[model samples]
Target: MKRAWSPGAVYVEFSSDPRDWPSVGVALLVLVGMGAALVLSFLVFDERRFGCMSGIEIGKTLVQVALRQLAQLASKNDEQLHREREELALQWSAELKAAVPQAVAYLESRVDDLDARIAELSSDPQLRRVYTNFNFEAHREAIDERRRMLAHAAAGLINPEITVERKARVERTLRALDPADILMLHGANLVPGRMRGESLLGTPSGGDDNPGRMRADLLLGTPSGDVLASSGCVRMQVSGGGAGQGVWTEVFITQLGLDVLTALRTYTQNRKLSFVVPGREYKETDRTEEAARKILAALPGLGDLVSWSTRRSSQVERLYDRPRPTRGFAVLRFRMCQWQDWKLRLENLIPIYDKAEVNLVVSAEVQARSRDAKREVFVAQFNGPHDLLRYPADDCEALWT
Candidate 1:
């Protein structure tokens, strides 16, 4: 018998001579025993046992590959998250940098204004004493910055009569009240004596008046007085002959109220917008012409079909002192010949009017006999920001109740 070897298998050749017969039989028996042993190993162990790597070795190799892949995936995710975070940080930083210049400019301008005002007031010894004696930090804690600035400006520049204690009280009250409530005090300050509470705070008295018109609730939840009355800026007095008699109420601005009104007016008038009409009485024709010019400027290129006229405020009838009209406002009424044209103009003008910030009371009204026959009017009046018109008791009650 001869044997030879290759890379994958072993080969054996047996001679056909009688002398090699015994050796061939021994070799055949040996090969059969080896095959039976291989079958027994397969039945006893897993199939992976016979592979290039054993069962345990193959499992270890697969686990190492899986771990390597998992580590690579986690690293990629971490890298992506880091890049996203960096991008957002850069974006916010750019926005903050862009806004910085405008903010700095505004602050510098305000500082310059205060410096000039202080320099002007520093000349007076009495004003110096008032400032030196004032508890600025305590007052600052009591009021917001905007109101504190106005109060200080008024006390220093406009009204020398405002005592330090009065300043403190006024600032506190101004902080407590809203712009509308302050305007209410201004309306009260216009009159000398006590006026009917309903005159300014209630609904208008007329056959076509809307008694159900919604009114905002006073911050001070009391039923009898407005926010001004609640804040001690105005005194509300109710009088009755007896329990069975009809009761009437009157309101008057207090000294504290006057200070608040003065401070607001002084500050606001100084910073009034360009288009706003100054708060002063105008002759009938002058008022009409000025209001017409303002309306035309805001809505340019209007044809002759749109006509405008100025009329005395209806409130003058009730608000004025007897015999002569002491104080009143003008209402500018615009009439359009065609209702469709009026609506189109009104819709286009509403946003424009608001954007202009003209500080005028703007409204639209429709006068119609039928849907087919109608007239539209766009009205603009300088009545401050609040409705100064006096209304009936029932209408006034309808607001809060």
Candidate 2:
């Protein structure tokens, strides 16, 4: 096949912007007649498909092939763009779709920060304080003196004068002993228990507790064992000081105190640790005849309403078997009015005076009928040491009797 240039004129006028300052946009423009050789150069022969020719058929086919390639390129570009969009959607919603850990990485990072903060706070030594509010520095003098006296007393119990065999036996006993062996403050050293089954408070039966008793229930039961052994209270406290220090309270720790005393009695058999208490009776007492006078004086007067029947025994004494506080408290019958400086005072005291000397107990009653007067009063009581923060005699009769 032979191809010829059709009757068509090709025209072009190159233009330039004045801003570019090009004096000429088209360097050359010419119109020339195509010779037969230029036409033949592109001549397409049907017999030869791969030959280089500038024929109209070849040029048309070339243009058609380029257009097809352009269409394919456009399709490929569209496919690539679609893939890119899908990949972006996957990156954003992977957590919502597949539940991958990376999806929650941002939230997990914040959670990790909180856990680290908690761990740091728990590990800080300042936060693990076992004892607080002793005013250790303020009363160092008195405390030091008391500590010295206790050291002396302890030394006397394990005196050097004792034979070596006896000392060894005592040491062995001490090693095996626990809190229960103590008669008073017996197992005061409430350190953690060791791997060996022997408890720090050391008694095997340390956790047994009784429930019928109210005061007996406030004790703490830890893994190591029980402390503050409960004993039925003997005396009632009158009043106490400080906030939450109310009177009309009961102190339940006879069992614990007795345990501590028992341990002491065992340790210091030969040497006795006897100290004068205000009202408690111990095994050792001076049998002076003057004591008889004191006892008689302390006795109730004849037909006196105050001294009618002092004999008292607890009914549910057995509930204090395991020795723990009620994990609770009771309200006092008598309370101080807002006008009083000592807002709440204990109407009763359990004068331990030795072990857990005095506790700030409080009790409250919405309506307490005055014994001496025909009036209902709101009453609260606390337990602790109290001084003159006194009420007038007439007021006591009228308000609390």
Candidate 3:
């Protein structure tokens, strides 16, 4: 079926809807024209629109380039900073190394100065004396402590139940000990042997005659007028008596003897064993007859009595006329009268007897001039028989005159 086409009406065609095709062709043509116009418009406005966007793109590119350059610059600056830090650290280390030897030298110099000062102090005499005193005090203290320990041990060994062999051993130990070690054992003060007159006898005497025996007389103070206790051996006797009448004390002077004597003396002094008499007890007795003979014998008028005959002549002299006296009885009477007058004169010139006494004194002093000096001083007095003196007789003339 075909339909006719009208301007405003519907038309039908039989050739497969030919009327619809013309309308379709017109719509296509209209669409084709619109597409051509759209293409043309795009071609014209594209350049102008893109030109506006070109500036924004270029700006973005420039910004990216700047950012890259800044990053490179920042990397270089970090490297420079690291290098400077390393250099500074090295400079500080070098300075510290350079100062080390100088600092060491300065410390060494200070130490040397201190050493010199110590040496100087050591050489000073006063300081040396002080050190010596300190050492002596320390040594003394140690000795005292040792003495105490030894005493305690000795006390333990002194038990009654102990064996005789052990007792002997302990006794031997004590005997072998030094004197100074046991000085304070008995709690008795003792004087040093050096301080005593132990060295007064220069050489030791020899022979069986004991010199220390004479010291006993000095120690005991036995009254015997003619006895002389001297260091050397010189025989002397009393004028009127035999050798037996004079009490002689022999001494053998030796170092060991002297030391023993000193110890004895110290012991005796501490014990107060010497005999003492009151001053009033000492009296002068009349012995003019006996003293006269001695005075007459010592007179210058008597020549040296070297021989027995000379000594006899000095005692008695005879006055005889060249011509034998006609009367022997008259000569005898004259001699008797002369003898009596001489005896009276001799008695007036001499003292017959003497009174002797012993004196003792003890003193102590501290030297004011010394610095840190010991304040204690020990002194003792021991007098002998020779120290006695005769009382002057009222009738007698002075011997010197």
- Candidate whose lDDT is highest: 1
Let me know the TM-score candidate 1 reaches against the reference structure: 0.29
Which one wins on TM-score?
Answer: 1
Show the lowest summed lDDT stretch of 10 residues, model 2: 314-323
Q: Against the true structure, what is each candidate's TM-score?
A: 0.29, 0.15, 0.16
Clashing residue pair totals per candidate (backbone < 3 A): 5, 66, 14
In model 3, where do residues sit more than 4 Å from their true spots? Answer: 1-53, 112-401
What are the per-residue Cα lDDT tens digits for candidate 3 across 203-247?
Answer: 222211123333333332432212212311122222213534534
Of 1 and 3, which scores higher on lDDT?
Answer: 1
What is the C-alpha lDDT profile of model 1 across 53-116, one tens digit per residue? 7656654554555558669999999999888666644543443344334333322332335445
| Residue 294 lDDT, candidate 2, scale 0-100 | 44
Candidate 2 vs 3: which has more TM-score:
3
State the displacement of the C-alpha of residue 86, model 1, in Å, after optimal TM-score superposition. 28
Candidate 2 residues lying further than 4 Å off, grouped into runs, are: 1-47, 50-54, 95-401
CA lDDT of each candidate? 0.43, 0.30, 0.32
